[model samples]
Structure formats: C-alpha cells, structure tokens
Target: MDAYDLHSGNGNNLSGYANAQIDGIISALAVSADPAERARLLAEAAPVLWDEMPTLPLYRQQRTLLMSTKMYAVSRNPTRWGAGWNMDRWALAR
Candidate 1:
C-alpha cells in the first residue's frame, strides 16, 4: 500500500500514485490487528486497486515444475528459496 499511497516517502512510492479512498483503506489496514478485519479490509481494497491500476505488470515469469505423479509433500516455496527448499520432506509413493 505504501507504494501507492499519497504521502509515502523514502522512495517507497515511485509511481506517484495517489487516491483518497485507497489512502484511507491503507491507513486502516496498517493499524488493524484483527485478522478477520484485516482480511475484510484487503477484500475491500483489491477491487479498488484493480480498478485504479496504479501500476501494471509488464511481464510475468513462466514457471514450470516437472515431477512424477507419485511425488508427495512438495512445497511451493518462493522463487528465491527455490523449489527444493523442502526436499527433506519430499516423498515418493510406492
């Protein structure tokens, strides 16, 4: 949200995107502690963000993981962590 906020500083908001409604939602989300309320806030914010389109994704990485069907316990770790991050827990069906 900082990236799209009106008063974001420290180079956090490069796009210079600003919207009052989103700003209020971002402020509320920042101090919110309740998980349900946070989720509700995010739910309320997503469509507004989409409609506003502060920034557009220019490219998307295409990832592929090939494994035998018997493979189990494979975890979808972040790209920086790599897919084998949880290799110890991986197993194969008999």
Candidate 2:
C-alpha cells in the first residue's frame, strides 16, 4: 500500500495527498448511509487530512468570461454538470 501511496502521490504532484484523502473520504461516505455519521467523519478528518499538505492554493480565479455579443442568452445552471453544451445556440454578431 505504501508503494501505491508513493506512486499515487507522485502522479498527483499538484494535489499531494489530497487526492488520496478525498478518495478515502468518498469511499467512506459512500459506505456510510447516515448523513450524521458522514458529517461527523468529515469534521473529524478534515483538519488531520490537511496536515499532509497534499494540495496548495496558489491563486483564486476572481472572474471568468465567455466573450460573446451575438449570443442572445448564455447562462449556466450550477446544478448542471458540464459548462460547454450550447455552443451551437450562439449567434454571430451583426
């Protein structure tokens, strides 16, 4: 398991142990049916999880743009999965 851990860690050099910890947490959450239990585990593990310094936040993206005037409407539903789905609906600018 240590070898796997080392390889996985190296493969995800940007996130360090974050990926592993998230995987573990997800797996634990999946197996746990109770919301309270899942919340408890997340609360207990969150601080310790960051102790490994698996990931670092370099900068934050304050704003983003699509850059289109032709399109009559372009909006994303946060509940939806992917962002790029309606490129065909965009119209050319006159």
Candidate 3:
C-alpha cells in the first residue's frame, strides 16, 4: 500500500512518464496473475528507472560470510539478515 501511495497519480502531478509507469506497475501487480507477464512489465519499467535513477548512492557497506566445508546450507542477504538468519533450515552436507 505504501508503494501504491508513493507513486499514485490521484491528484499530485509529480512527473509524467515516471509517475505513469510506476503507478501502472504497482496497480497492475495487485491483480497480475501471469508471472511471466509481470516479469515483462517489470523489465519494461527497469530501463525507465535506470534512466531516472531515483536513488543516488553515496556510500557502501561490507559484510563477510564464514562457513565450514561441511556446512552446505546457508543463505547470504546483503540487505537483510545475513547467512545465519534462517539457521533452522540449515543441514549438513553428508
């Protein structure tokens, strides 16, 4: 809902093309049944976002994951909790 509000074309005239594409994507996603069609729509919008660059990065963060050779199940997420977040699902390699 937040995203829907963020790029809504209800009354605010933020920008033309970006607003239309963004709101279109968000609204369409609510009822989009075909995953492949969704992918195509997402792909269609990516370049427009790239051209606009809504978020300009200023810095970076670094993280490391350490695992033993025998431990085979680990997930690494740079943006969220790291490799141990889902330790409940981890298993040995055998």
Q: How does each model score on lDDT? A: 0.73, 0.55, 0.65
Quick one: best lDDT, which candidate? 1
**Better structure of 1 and 2 per lDDT:** 1
By lDDT, is 1 or 3 better? Answer: 1
Candidate 2 collision pairs: 15-54, 17-54
Error of 2 at 55 (Å): 0.2
How would you encode candidate 1's per-residue C-alpha lDDT over 1-94 as one tens digit per residue? 3333343432566787777777777788778899999899889888987998877878766656778899999867654446888899999999
Query: Which scores higher on TM-score, 1 or 3?
Result: 1
Between candidates 2 and 3, the lDDT winner: 3
RMSD of each: 5.6, 7.6, 6.6
Clash list (residue pairs), candidate 1? none
What is the overall TM-score of model 3 with all chains considered together? 0.47
Model 2 residue runs over 4 Å out of place are 1-23, 59-94
lDDT of 3 by residue, 1-94 (tens): 1234436464433333346777778678668989998888778867876887654447655668888888866768634445677788788887
lDDT of 2 by residue, 1-94 (tens): 1212322434634335445555666567658989899898678667765676544557654434465676665666342334455656756668
Ranking of models by TM-score: 1, 3, 2
* Clashing residue pairs for model 3: none
